[model samples]
Target: MMSKSNKMLDVQAMDTSSNTVLSVRHLKTYFYPDDGSVRKAVDDVSFDVQRGRICCLIGESGSGKSATAMSIINLVDRPGKVTGGNVLFGGRDLLTLDTKQLRTVRGASIGMIFQEPMHSLDPVFTIGEQIVETILAHEDVPRVEAAERAVTWLKRVELPNPEAIMTAYPHELSGGMLQRAMIAIALCCGPKLLIADEPTTALDVTVQAQILRLLVRLKDEIGLSILLITHDLGVVAETADDVLVMYDGHIVERGPVEAVFDRPQHPYTKALLLTRPIIGQKLRRLPTLHEVMREVDDGEIAQPKDWSTLATTVQTDGDKGEAHSTDANGNDHDSTPILTVRHLSKYFERVHGLKGEGNVKKAVDDVSFDVHRGETVGLVGESGSGKTTTGQTVLRLHSKTAGEVLFDGIDVFALNNRKLAKLRTRMQYVFQDPYSALNPRLKIGFAIGEALLHHKLATKRDVMDKVVETLELCGMDSSCVNRYPHEFSGGQRQRIVIARAMALQPEFVVADEPVSALDVSIQAEIINLFSELQHRKNVSFLFISHDLSVVEHICSSILVMHHGRITERGTVDDVFNHPKDDYTKSLLDSIPASNPKYRKIGR
Candidate 1:
């Protein structure tokens, strides 16, 4: 009898047919850094993508998902080498192909959509120029014809006003529009296989739904094979035909979507599914990866801790305090509001159509709301709906075009430069991208302590001590202080960013999409950290994000914005359960269902 490993290989080998568009066998990609140690980014990864099927690779960050994708097309950057294995497609081994030969197959046969469209697309070129160039590169078409085809592709992707979009640069379009454009460019060549890496990771729910639907349509209409790499289990459940669970550069589990979701065998897979925030189910505290698994001497083991005990401990600690106190409408009627906005409006002057005629754009139009002390108020909307602007304006990051902001009963707009500078210590803003928010050159320790020193909150001798304390509060330790931002992972960098914000012990914090880019496991930890901070410091938060589920989990109340105006406001229970506004209803509907059996079919 054949060995078990040989039997598995035989099963995969038999899958070769016209139905199988691509096959990766025992592929290994290793990165050799200057430290003389080798990192196995992708080790012995094997999978097959069937024609007209969506195969999703699901895992947390640094799980070798992207490395596997890159290795398949021989696109692994330097310092990283594909040392072994074969990628078979079209009767050819892609790994053995020369650079010139691979170039012919990359765009004409296999297309890829990167995670960040802004970085993937050329900044100086018009959207139309980029799309037309992509078409021209693969086909023997005239420039004029290519331009027309580009417009058609944009329209095919459901972008409105294709003509205007053709003329607009990448920066001029919204996040949804840019993502649609990236899809248009990738599919224009009509490739057999398309690789999409975290395509909807940064988008709002409504836009994400549209993009997912568009991909399904393309797959059905063109018989396209898609290899999707993402950390979102919800998306995987909704879109994938087959699931491949990756962990620490290994394929731990593989099966049909329904099978994997309904009865996950791997402990990592089970932990990932549980970490996501379910829309209707509200827990006292979200379960994290550490609670679901523990590390062993050889590797990690699945040992789920008892949640009841944890919940009881949290309740007995009495850390919730006034933060959990609310009436039927989710309003703390007895507590005074800490921050208030009255008739706030912000505008920008734009010159359009080469006429130099000034046009006023209202980013925040007469927005008014109040944030009570020790409460989290969610500001949610699609891109360009003014959620970020409202947060920034409240913090006075941007000068208001009209209206007034009162913090602690003092008019914020009436303050002079000196007074405003002094007040910054009391208010802090946590930006969306932690990578951009932190200085790459500065050590994380200095980054967190700079504010403490500049504001005279700590002396040089005690600044490091305060920094370490803040880091500990954010689940990091003193060792992180000596490291630069580049040395840490996305989740770790975010913790440092939060530490920097909390170091000042501000009364109020504006967190803009703080957990949007994180994996489900990391997102849970961050959400819990936010709750802990609120319980300990009684800090008020204006949490800005496009994800409704996350907002409903942590916030007491929510404010919905559209076209720079507040369209709805209510308690979390009232707003999410019985949303009155049509936009709010649509946002709620757009969230991907966590269970595959309940996934919505068709557009």
Candidate 2:
């Protein structure tokens, strides 16, 4: 029965000819855990990546999408082994090649760009040296010539200063620049097939747009076939010619990009598409994988409902926290603000190289914003634009150089450390990186209940019940309470972090990039949960992120920041439809729409 349950899903045949660049037939990769359990990571996955086309493998975490890519490259490490597969690359079976032959063909015939540049890049060596080594590995070139070719490839990827970037280490460059450098390294050998695993996952929307365009340009001009593995349907919609939907180690559906998106055949694909948030529309609750799988027995699957209609019912009375909130009597809404920041400013004293003189860098320059009672105020900008700093300063995590922060008409900046520490329970902070935000040593239950126990919000007898309740609210099971932070996946860890903050039952929360690491479906679930929590508990939120669609969905109003200043502020519809600032318009333009029938489809 277990083996039958692990059986592969039936996949449709591809409509490709003999010009395929990469083909995998009946691929099966299994992992042998110490507990005597077989984890079928990539089971019977088959597809063809045509020459000069992009085939996207998209799914949630642990869906075997990345495993399929790894199996093709024969990079499955440790107890995981590819038991059955045929990886046909350029008419040659890649699975039969030994290490010596695989190394020769790896960079020269098939290049790969990893998901995290920081991990893939060597901090000890310069960028140029690494690229030169990769080039020298494939070709018999001189050191000087190989270095020159590395610079040329960097320039081809549109880096502003290739020569300077060559000498710099990976830590010196920004996330986007490091990504470009990684691309340069991958393409330095001029491989025919390029495999990218979530290349633009960490980048901001604008930078992601640039990277996607670069990939497209390379595919067109260089005649490169790209196998792009990503969970972002928006990226797949804009970049992919063909789409492959993977679920639980199986290829559930496959078709052309538009055909697959406009009319998804499989239930998993339909659920994924529905989970993606529309820019203007809102949602009462996101559709989950359980809902989709349960309805598979039904003959026909209907199109997803327009969430805007259902969302209105929630906004009209349930989730309405406009410029005001409903009173405790459940009667009329009030217009009074909960938290207000007036002329906030934070500066860092930086020293010039070899010079001890201070160079003032204002991270948050005169940023003013307000969070109404039970309302969500979105703070959005590209990296280093002071979004996080503003939220941190308001929480008094950093010393405010100037300005007033008023919480319920009480000036918070004037409070001493002792007073501020006591008041922190009322204003909690959910950090950006859940991987680093959580304590590694604590159990999941203790981590969530720590605040409640510390602040005496609940007695010892009732704290466990409260913790379990909050965990359920965050969509986590009660069985996970005994698990450690390392035991959970990225999305699960993020939910646990939110549950930690929710346990405090604060009147206000500063959520910094809470859902950025999540997939579309998980992101929607967390965002909808935030809305429900706000409605039930009368909690205000400062939602900080570079994701515009998420901001528009959850936030009643948005505050646009650029160069450490508040450039524009308005309602979600007003700011999105009619923008006043140049940066605001640019940000809105950078947003990749998930609608498959867009004008620039598959550009």
Candidate 3:
């Protein structure tokens, strides 16, 4: 057994003179708000990134992981200053360096890949121009030479048609392509240390896999050390040589990946690992971080008395013991499908170069599926696979270019404005981004009740009461009604969004990546909430997501979409256990294994 000090990676005990690429000691970053309250974002955090190794910083949102990373590079912005820290890189204390000196070290010795590449990369510049600019900032190379190097870097990052990508604007590229461009820009100068902050969070599963594989390959080829900051445990298990578990501004635990995951010492670490939904381990409800922390004993996590009961049943009440069961023709014969999409197609016309010549892009082409009542029918695909477009088209959020959408036997597309408005009461859409889905200026109560009142579903006097009840049902407090959207966390905001949708008592919902931006524990809570709602209300759902493991857990059946078409459709058991389509198989294979022992070796 390793001693506590040994497992903690104590900086004093280790020989940091040789192998350590970057050493952060007693880092403290505090934010001073206008109200004069000092919030400790990163408090006394210490860690070492070994040369040519990946050290994953794992934590929930607001746990100071990103702050610690930013502080190391002396990039903590105004209002949030690094109170105290020693960031030693190449025998130089970065904190002591001035603005000009720090700038020299930033791109030359250390590179950073932000979570959102679109925001990180300048919108006005071409991908090639940005990479060249980065190179020019650090080195005294000729403009022509820098341009050539940029193309080389793009190729090295495994981007296809490097020359075209260089000439293309950031908006012209896909999410995955933009990310690759960001990596190219960061690594063009050949930085020894890389800080990747949630680089794959918003990406599709396959794209994420590609990015992770690219990072590993680059590390091997260039001998680059990485400080990978993320809230995902699976990513840590798959890629990290060492692990740092952070909580609320403290380094709760630090150790080798195998040791930390196999035998977690801290209660928080254990809770994080246990709360995440595994691919095959189906449970009635996933235990939340709060539940696990409540049962903490000493430094270890203790399961609650009812923990055993939580795993007893894989089927929810809505399943009615018919989970993964389908008829001979791969249809639910028990009842007619609540929502049917036949030959659905959505197209966008692109006018190029002001030539007056328009080319039609088929976003969704001949897509068809059925979502049965009291069932969760998953729509799984890559980012541009038309999942979102299909969902929106079904809800009439986007005017369909072709085909028919029958909701409870009424053609949704053929409805008049007044009839469509009435039909909206029976159907609702949960957008991907909860923050953007809501009106920021509106109070939580008003945001929820406005729809009800406008639809004449509730009177003005009783609207607040109805709002409070729905909020509570979604695992929130009655007090949340008076609060604004900006006041709540990402998970809480998602709950509020769900509450707003449920308040309508819609028979069918088009949930589009509702839990994609959330923490793992929060995702479990939301998934469990969905299950509870389905069980209680017997409502059907068209759950659209790129996450296959999540879909496997909550969805009874699934439809695999690729190139705006349903390539395959079947029960969860048939599709997941024995996928016929190649795309479906690749997606399942892309899911990172939670255990390091089973980590995929290569792309």
For each predicted model, how many residue pairs clash, with residues at least 3 apart or on different chains? 0, 0, 0
Candidate 1 per-residue lDDT, tens place, 1-603, comes to 111112221122427878999999999999999989999988888889999999999988888999999999999998999999999999999999999899888887999998889999998999999999888888999999999989999999999999999999999988888999999999888899999999998888898898998998989989999999999987887799988888878887788898787776566676677677778765667767655443211133333233323322232133442233232134543288889999999998988786889889899999999998888899999988999999999989999999999999989989999999889988999998999999999999889888999899999999999999999988898999999999998888889999999999899999999999899999988888888788678888999988888888888899999999999999899899999999999998898987788887443
Candidate 1 similarity to native, TM-score: 0.90
For candidate 3, write residues 93-141 as lDDT tens digits: 9999999999999888899999999999888989999999999999999
Q: Model-by-model lDDT, in order?
A: 0.85, 0.83, 0.85
**Sort by TM-score, best first: what order?**
3, 2, 1
TM-score of 2: 0.92
The alpha-carbon deviation from the true structure for residue 264 of candidate 2, after best TM-score superposition, in angstroms, is: 0.7
Runs off by more than 4 Å, candidate 1: 1-14, 123-129, 141-151, 163-169, 295-334, 352-356, 601-603
lDDT (Cα, tens digit) per residue for candidate 2, span 547-591:
998888778788999989999999877899999999998898888
| Model 3 lDDT-worst window of ten | 1-10
Taking all chains together, each candidate's TM-score versus the true structure is 0.90, 0.92, 0.92
Better of 1 and 3 by TM-score: 3
